[model samples]
Target: MALCPISLSLPTLQYFYSEMRGVDQENEVNRILGAFKLNPYEQLGLRFDCDASALRRQYRRSSLMVHPDKCPHPRAKDAFEILGAALKHLEDPERKSNLDNALSFAKEELLKDWRKATKHDAGVRLAASLDARGMEGVEAAHVATPAFAEAWKARSREVLGRAEWRRRRMSKRIKEEEERGREEHRLEKQLNKNIVEHEKAWEKGRTERVGTWRDFVAKKAKKSKGGPVGGIKPPKRLRALLRCYQQLSKARLSLLVTATASAGYVAGSREQIDWVGLGWTTLGTFMAASCANTLNQVYEISNDALMKRTAARPLPSGRLSRPHALAFAAIAGVGGIWILAGKTNALAAELGAANIALYAGVYTPLKVLSVANTWVGAVVGAVPPLMGWAAAAGSLDLGALILALGVYFWQMPHFMALAWLWRADYAAGGYRMLSLVDPAGLRTARVAFRNSCYLFPLGLAAAWLGVTSPYFAYESGIVTGGLMLCAAKFVSSRSTANARLLLYSSLVYLPCFMLAFLAHRKPNDVDDRLELVMGHLRSLGLFRSGVDREDEGEEREEDQGRVAAGTSGSDGAQSIAPTPGASRPLPPLSPPILTGDFWAGPMVGGLPPRGAKS
Candidate 1:
């Protein structure tokens, strides 16, 4: 039977009551257990050797038996509370260690004191028996012998108890180390299993993700196949045709020609536009530009291969043969001039052919030979607008020249900036540019600035020549002044940044100034001629009845004075109100300029001189 801690001492019961007396009796058993003081393992009905789980199991059994509701004993609640506290104390490593230390110290002290008392008692008994058995004369000698025997017996028992305690401790330590090793091996196997499971999960997820990506690609390909390019492979001939077309066109630069041509057509024609003629002119210009561009590429293929900038072009990259390129150029060049001559006018056709000749024949070879190539290239670029103007009017005129000169001046800063940026490339390609030749950029900067200076006078000349309104003089002054300022900055700095500013200013000035000139063009001459015709018609009606037209005109001198006073400012006002009694009773509408006929009529054969013919 196990010795119960409670049964060992009646003082223990009293001590337990004393500890529990101050604690709240009305509290739950667990709370009471937390405050309770008792031997934890003993309260749980476990030996000190029991493991944590055994302690816990014994605690549960004891708690169930001593529970206040089930046992119905006065001490049952206390027992349950104590049992809960014991379980907690034993479960906590720190509290359990303190309890074990106290128990061990108490056991050690008790054993030491018992050894002293036993030695004293054994010495007294042995001495008394020795005194009874020995002769009276040997008492002193026997005294030391009995004492030594008792001390030896007491020391032997102490040594045996210490050896037993040490043996149990060593056994416990070995069992604990073996248990720890088994636990570590179990954990190692578990970790390996977990790692394998994680890898499997990762691979599965990766496979799913890859499958999803493949599905997306397949869906995209299917969708794309149903759309343009259609899944079917293009024929070799068709591919070659497309590749050749792209290489020959140089679409972006051709658009500039188309734009200037449109501007020129607007500036040249006073009557309604001829859309069919304009279309032919644009198409002709595009073909001319395309032909020139292809020829230039063909001629420069070897040089292009030397420059990084041009090395990837179709010709230099060997994507298209020279024979194919030459054939395309010949066909486009001849075809473009023929279209212009047949559909537009001889002057436009000649300008288109000249533009091609200058760009390909003169400018292309000139690039390698001389820096003057830039000037020739600018002249070439300026021809498109002239072509358009010629196409519209069937001849070159002041307006056409003005438009062309504006384009010519605009390219100076534009090309100079580009040349400065690509000077090294141009050097590698053996092209002579001002940027490369001057090195200091002084000449290039001066050229750009000088052209900007010329642009202002050119703009004013356009206004003075009656190509645009006087407002254009003022507006163009500001625009040109800004461009000149940018050029001046480039001249002073000779920096790429300043050059870029000048270049961008040129780009902005060209289109804006062209549009401004087009927007504010002088009102059609047809208006004044139409007014003269209307006046003549009114005079004819008076002539039919033999009325004196001269006297009627003289009578309206006072009315004319009043109208002139009202209209005589620099406002460009036109007066169409007839002198009083000069015509029929119909009130004059605004001048023929206001009527749509000034702008919307079919092309006039030619303007008749005033008073020359109806």
Candidate 2:
């Protein structure tokens, strides 16, 4: 008690103070790690309604106490980061406002419960308690009684629990929505990828598909020879005949030619169709087409051997000798010409001969020399229809010309698609096709699209020329429009898939277009049929015969007056009076007969039966 004080050096004092600071930091780190992490105010040990400056001051003091450089705690970095995050959250205006509102709501609910329990407002009690204690802080625990402090803590816990649940639910819902959007986007991308892969695979397997088709054809030919027929082996003679048949003709193409020839015959005839004559016409057309095809094979044998698609042909495969093929062509040509001349007419025979020569001589030779062979081939396809028209009507007319033009225009798109599809084969065969010359397929697709456009007008022309009804125009328009759309797709993207689509559409378009023409063909004997029906109706007393006779007499008088007036003209040409039983011309069939409002007889002023009431 009586000893003198000993002073320490300045560095020792500084070191002692550093040791105390380090201990305080370690303790602060432990407290920060132990605090509740969800609530910023709880994590920072601050009241809800603290001002921004006080929040910053408290955050800095807490951060220094838990600084990782000074603290010796294992979780010092984690604690420091947590403390910094808490400070940031409290500084946010929206976050601070929400916290303040939550705390006030919790205090209000506590006061209500207190009033119900003690029969007095907790606010008044809290104020009186605070005045008595003389507390300067805004914290409820600093001024409130112990009972109020416990109630406030319970209410705050309940409010914080509900708020945490709502926040988690909102976060989960947002994640679910985001996951659903990603799944939909992934599915759409996968679908697009699959489509592209399918198209690529289809194009890549084109040669394999062609080979398979050729194999199938060869197998069918073998079956026809001696393999099996309906599970029974064919006789040797029958097999020999089948082999000769295969060697002599391309069956599908010949049948198509015959069918087109028959269509032309049907379209041209204004009188009753001669079924016997049609049979002869089909036979002659088939022979003529076979002759052309056989001769073409004979000339292209070497080239055909070089190509995949044509290598399996009889001439190229050596299934038929050149001399035998030449002899077959000769026989077919002579036989076809003779039959046409004997059964039909000179014009039909002449057309048959010309087509054979054009196809075998012009088109076949031009195939290797120039791309104009396609046009020549189209002309060759066009001749059969003319031959049929000649066989039926014994002459060519506008209707015949229209039918031939249809065949001509149709061949362009049909052959262009086929040529583009087999461009590699054509190039290997040394044929100078449009597709071969235009490797990018630009001109080939352009040619196809342009020809498709021509088909629309050709349909309208048929209707305009009175060869078919207006219904045919509408029907053909739809069919050709579809073809045009396919061709346009090929033009835009020269893919094998699109080219194949155009080819299929062309195949369907031809048959449909021909059938529409036949279905809507304007009957030449409509007036005759109408007169015969009217005469029968008069015989049955449905119309008065005396009235019809009177009308005919008046018409004769008017005709005679016109003839007399004509004889008095400066040209002095006398007009003949109409015959007594001659039928009046029928009007064009514009509207469909299936409609309720259609009246065929009234269209040509033939209704009311001359004297019947309207």
Candidate 3:
């Protein structure tokens, strides 16, 4: 047998080695896919304590084994990518340090657990006794035992699992915080960009704005020289007076206030209409409103100059001086209170004074301070109707309260719509309105809608309280229902079109509702109603009896005898002679005496005397 072993061919050995390498790559891909995903060290099959070079070498080996081109496994690509990511994580100094700390902490916990168990376990104690005689430390020798080694492995895995979970949580939290910071920074950058663009645009238009203002001034100057007024040029004094009127008050709003006062007076009147009283009440209310409005413009001059809607106002446009405006307000205020106190009652005068103070003192300053100023403004709007009622009735009664509350509630939807439509202007003017704060308009819409709903019940309450007939409720329901629908549409769309629709609806609703109320007004006299009640009670024998009834019968007989004697005279004529001891019938009731230009009208026939024939 001296022929010896035959030499293997090099190509055959290379082919076999290639087959083995392919099988090894497939196996590594499976192992990587099966490893714990949270821990990068576990995925790469590298120890947590491994240095950057060692980690890099292991990652390279693992990645090559699971490379998609080399491995036949379907998940080879995923394993290769995962191995690359693990290498990147371990390469970072901070990440590597955190992992090392986690591993050290896990090892320390495992040793502590082991020592605690060994204190009670006989087998672990025997292992520790043997370690006492050996060169290794007792804890290390104990960990070398099969039982302690199994426990240490489990405890280390558990501790590393907790550490990985904490790291994932921390990473998620940090990412969220970074995202929030980036969003805030982006918004700030956009805001600054917008401000710069706005300033640039304003600067570009400066020359045009100045030219337009000059043209306006020239036109005004020409008008003062001699311009067409009501188809004919007026005298200088007349023009100046008209200009003063325009500067002192808003005519349309003042007229609306006077109309509301007239409505309240008519509603509250229980007897024949007091047209003279109505005139005085309306005039006084208008003057007070004008005073308040002028004071408001005076206070908000600087703020008004910023808003496009208010920039052309008298005070802001420099058409009216502050001192002149103040003087006008003072005269209007004093004159208004004087008229109310002298022509109307003291209560109406006090209410007028208080309303002026509320509007100019409290509401004006509060406009820039709080969103609640809108509600305070509603209260100011309410006082006019109450003043009218007090002027006619000489007291604040339940009917007056209902009328005032209607005005109060109506203003919410009306002004809320206006506020929403002019939110940008309000913001520019530095006023704190609800619409300005509620960017989405949810709150403003809710407020408007809620107040509109209140109108429905208020109408019913007015009828229930005998302020108006039941028919007014039906009419008011239809009107307020439309307002509510408009409000709801605004809430749904939050668009300018919907808000404008709501505003128009509110404007229509007030006039229609007031008209309906006036049409269905219950105008029964208080004295007549009270007399009827007393007569009914007496008929039921609840009031008078015996001697009182006899005295009433004798008085009735005596009145009948006098009437018969007067009628039975030779001529069929009315008697004008006064009885010696009989008290004369009370004179016809009339309105309080008027001074100055006003004169009391003759008393119109009302209900007949209490016991007289109809």
Candidate 4:
């Protein structure tokens, strides 16, 4: 990733045609020139007078070239990176020499590749030069041009190809040998089967003889014996989901579109997930959301109990066991992928897994550890829509990213106001938010105002790029920006009243913006924003809007009841009504539970919530 420019900032004759990938342009060219190795303008391929005019002229051309994104060659890209890093280093006068030193090192490496290539060519030409030396003399025998270098490279290629072939063949032989050993072991097991069978037969005969002798003896000696041993039956909970939920955070689950929901409008109004293509993305989103919500419970259950607003939650209320909570998480996490795999494509499944991992693995823990978690959570929240986009498009869509980023950036103002309102509770609960940082709400208010202000530029880009319609642009600008301004001027700067207004505005802004974005019915627009939204809605059926348990319980119960009644053919079988939170009543008491030594199946049913990595 280091892109310090050296002499070979441009494609060095060495790796230019062979290795250049992201580093192929002036973007890198200018970057390399500025950051990597520049003692003076003259040194960086410039002829500037020691004046501002010449320096500005050079800066313009340089800037155009090393724009990073503009680069066409792999080396150019590398150079651009180097240039940027170097610039950052040079920005501090104290660090300029350090950057220069690093650039020098990078340039050396680039030159090394180039010179070695040239040297190899020179060595190969020694033979031809010798032949010429015999025919004409030292003067006529010399080869100075790039032709000699090509000859050397050709020979090198031929030699390397042979070596690669030999290596591959050796690798194959080694693998085959290992496979043969495994096969022999399998054959050995087959051969031992007969011996084991003979031993079983012998044991059976011996047991029969012993029983007969013992019975004969016991007829005269024994009178009575104890009947049976029994123990109280333990109450059963759904183990699979529990186990899955426990193990869920690490497993590959399907896409759950739950993250965007908490985001309120953003979740709803954002483009649709292609149910057919990106269902797993929805699964991931759900896993992330579920994980975030759950982790909040895990870390703040005690704190939540102290708060009147949160005391009714499963954990705080003691309605849900921690193990059960863990298990539920596991189930939801892995089940995400399981459901998605069957319903959508492979990519969706992977995205779901990734989302769970990020949310559960990274974001969750961060809540207990640092304030940065909110930002990280925001990032996790944004990924679901992207996943939705990818699922529908079968590729990455910029529109999805634009929408996601708009939401991500918007979180600052959106959450700051919330943080301010709940600062006291958050501090009491040990939750870090902007309000916690600034108890008076000054800093939190400012951040909300600032982020709301940024929505204009971000929203404008989305509008101009056709990610959404002009309607969204105007609406979002008025809603987000206006609210933020109000909070800053009236609420943020004054007592908490206006701050509350700002927070309310933010809550309103998010959902309203998303709704407006969704409402944009631009006939001429090429993006399938509406189509994707409709598709996901169709897949989710009528309940897409409300995934809350209260809303879903009845529907789930009905479906399970229908399936159970149809399947329960025997009248004598005992059954329990739906377990708490389960779709239906527990299965009849006859079936054996899959657990301990008797339990055998896949370790997990589906993908778990994504763990955080980046």
Candidate 5:
């Protein structure tokens, strides 16, 4: 769409709107005014002095498309009214400038009111007073402190109320202007009808050339000469700079994932890790994960371009060519494997390579086919910690396997929370996150809570039996697990805001508890290896060496039987409620899109449109 030749002149436009919405369209002056509204003074070909009937016909056609009823919105009630008013103002030369002046003046008055109203904010006032002495331990003067505080509080309310009132007043004024615009539009409709009839009459009589010198000049001015033969233009140096920036961003993401994964490796090995080997394993895992992320992006470029949020990303936006992305992927992938093989044990390097291949080559595509992709993604996500442990321990042992399981189990809740926040984006991009499909959020919340619940005993057992640390297990069980349980309880609220709070809680809980375990040390606490292994097994819910798969299955049934038997005939036995927020799943932060007010949910309003929109 070419921008109108006329200046934006919102103030003038505001004036025109007030005069447009009349029901009458037969007046000559009204038809001319409608033409002016349709084509402003700066338009190259359109003339204000045209015969009225021809212009009237043209505007009537346009009104159909611009009518409020045709283009629906939440606030369609006043759309046509505003358009009519603009037409009305333009139809009359006398009041066009008057309309502009009133609008300009009204805007200024409202802004002034707004400024005065927001001059005192409670948070700011409280902060100032507290900071004057000290917020940490406020020790301000005690001279009539209560009275002063009370006065301040009252004044703050007054100011805040004034601000709110001013905002409402501004909205009302805007609505009023729309009404005036409707009357103007009605007037313009008349002028248009007259201009169009005049044009028809002229055309009826003409059997020969009828081009005016003005028409010829207007036609010449509209043409733009162009020369093109489909030759491609190379990206400018600045474009190249932007490409580098995107690569760096991807690199930065890789570095962080690697570093965090490395931390786990180091932390995992404190019990039985070889320090030198662990360092090598960290080197390999970091490179491998980074390589995989690059590959995943390269593969998903087509899908990314279809998502609003992802469309502007490097590969999808054509910032970097496919070959370039491919080359980067290979370099990262090959270099990462090399690092792992050279620095860590062969087993660590091999596992790292396998994970990368599985994630990028297999699971990445699985996202489109199955929601079980979450499980696949988790398995891939869990590989890094094991890579770390293997880097230190040189191979997978029972303890390392248990530790890996913990990571696999932890990912569901963490990613589900993220999926809730980005549900729209996932749905828009056609990425299969559980939260996207479950609008009720019941299944998402249940799975999230259940996964967290199961982790409690496993985490404690990992610490107690010496798979990790006893202190870490107890702390994880009592504190982190309890916090998750509380967050789970809140997931059944009617507002996505509560779900959003739970999502935040979940994100916080994982990292904090993981760090807590890493920070604990329990070396040499027990002398006998046999006794230590036995303790670990018992904590893990294993009775003895004789226990097999069948026995373990039976034990689980018996435990469930106890729980079921105890809860029999009781409605309160259920651990969690359904759809905490009524029907809508969790949202992110605050400010729900459906609600006028701001609150948080898992996936809030900021994500891209649905998957079908390019």
Candidate 6:
């Protein structure tokens, strides 16, 4: 048949054309949202029980693929609009419930049909034929038609298809999540690298500026040398003074001294702590350390000038005169000892004085004479804790000795590695360090390893002495084992790399050990004794109970007045108040006197008698 061309421009034809386009668009929307082709579960790429967050995540991911801006396909805009509408439909309670009910009804219908088909006469005949294996009977009864065969086949396909679909969905989701995590990790690493580079650049610029300034000042000093003033005219008076103080005090080392002192105070104080006394002890230790350091600089001025490491020190650099250094040392030394003796105790003061003498008098001179100076320096390092202990306890005890020994053992590995690192400097300065004298480094490595081994027992000793809990022993053991491993490595290789490793380990080990010790510090024998005495006093009405103080305040005043009157007499014995009309007089009472120093004195099962010496 011959066909005529239809004009789409006509009103009736245009209307028909628009209607066709609308129908086509509706079909595309249905295909994209899977309204008829897929279940709600498959549409959202999730199981029925998926949570809201998972639903949102999957919906957003699908939307991204269909987004008009990203896809720019003719179908994508329709797909995305339809996906948004479907998400809204699923999100609504009534619409979602209706969809779920319809799905469930369909499944029930399928299952009912499957169940009914199994019970039909045709199924019975089929089963009988298959069982008998009679080809003639099977062919007559339609042997290919088994019981619920189509339903079972359809159900199997559904089961396998659902599982495969979910498997693919989950595998793809996992891969995408992992990729996201890796990208985030890469970005984080890049950010950290940028920060580190910034810090490095800042440090480099600062170091260059400092070097340039130093060179400028040095050149100026050299130019001034030929003038009336000497070659090393000091900088501005205040600047020179500050530099001298920093060099003379050896401020970097003072931190270690202070930390050890604080640790010792914590270990030694059993009953109670006197914060004021601890402050005094720390200040005294720092002052004494500063004084000793000043004396050491004075003694090694020439040697220091020879070594690159020590060339910029106060005396060697001529920033301060010898007389000024001596004056600072004398003042600091005397002031430190006085603070200890007056504020703390005689023993602490004695230890501080001894440390100063040992470090300057013995360690300093012996550095030139013998390699044994390192041992003396270790002794000096050990005494600060003893000073702290004596400051708090007013006596040296087993715990104090153990702490001192720990410090002593710790310094051997610490200094041996340091000596190895700086052996050339020591040789240039004519100082006889073990690393410089023992050319093979065998003895130095052995000593370091041996001392590290000693720390194992040292940590255990703190626990055994009841200064710390048993956990400290385990913690300290692990850290000490690490140090020992480093020491052994240095011994085997005798290389600078191994030596640096040992140095780093020792530095890490000391603070960790100190922290463990502090964490595990327990109440010791003194605390028990003090508690006992306080309980006895409370029972005897000599001390007030802490509870119900508002009610007992008047009674406490009356008791204090009575005790005061009883002690007013010249004789040591005072009469106790007797009951009214009692025939027998109360026995004479000898009450003990309470003083500020009483708690620090010896315990006697109770408070000591009045007038008894501590």
Rank by lDDT, descending? Answer: 2, 3, 6, 1, 5, 4
> In terms of TM-score, which candidate is strongest?
3
Per-residue error at 99 for model 6, in Å?
99
Q: What TM-score against the true fold does each predicted structure earn?
A: 0.49, 0.49, 0.58, 0.40, 0.46, 0.49
lDDT digits (tens) for residues 240-281 of candidate 4? 445434332323222224534223222223344233333344
Off by over 4 Å in 4: 1-288, 490-494, 521-614
Q: How many times do residue backbones clash in model 3?
A: 0
Regions of model 3 farther than 4 Å from truth? 1-234, 524-614
Candidate with more favorable, higher TM-score: 2 or 4: 2
Error of 2 at 466 (Å): 1.2
lDDT of 1 by residue, 1-614 (tens): 36676578778878887556424332334443443144555445444445777876776766665677755446667767677766777778997786666555554554566456656576656655767554332333532364543443344445445656787999998997787677546544654564465457657777777798798677667867454443434686578777666766787888888889878877777667778888888888888889999999998876776678877777866567799889988998899899999999899999888888889989999998889999999999899989888888877766788889999998998899889988877766767788866767999999999998888987777766677877888888889999999999999999989988887888899878888888888643544434444455544442111122223345456567767866885777775465434444443423544432222222234342223213
Which model scores highest in lDDT?
Answer: 2
Candidate 6 structure, TM-score to reference: 0.49
Query: Taking the tens digit of each residue's C-alpha lDDT, what string does model 2 give over 548-571?
Result: 444645766789898888777887
TM-score for candidate 4, residues paired by index: 0.40
Model 2 weakest 10-residue run by lDDT:
595-604
Ten-residue stretch with the least lDDT total in model 1 = 542-551
Clashes of 5: 75
For residues 1-614, write the lDDT of model 3, one tens digit per residue: 43333344666778999999988887788888887665688788865555778877887788778888878889999998888887777778998777667667777787776567666777756665677554247666555666754554456578778876888999998997787677546544654565565567767988988899898777766666544632334576578766766766877887787788888889888758888888988889889889998998899876776778777776766566789899988988899899999999999899999999999999999998899999999999888888888888887766777778888999998899899998767766677889866767899999998988887788887766666778988888888888899988988888899989999988898789779988888874555433444344444434332333345456667778878788889987885444655643322222222212212222125322233333
TM-score computed on alpha carbons, candidate 2: 0.49
Which of the two candidates, 1 or 5, achieves a greater TM-score against the reference? 1
Q: Residue by residue across 46-160, what tens digits does model 6's lDDT show?
A: 5443577988997887777667775645677878876776688788999777656655454455556644665556755666667666544533344235443344334444654
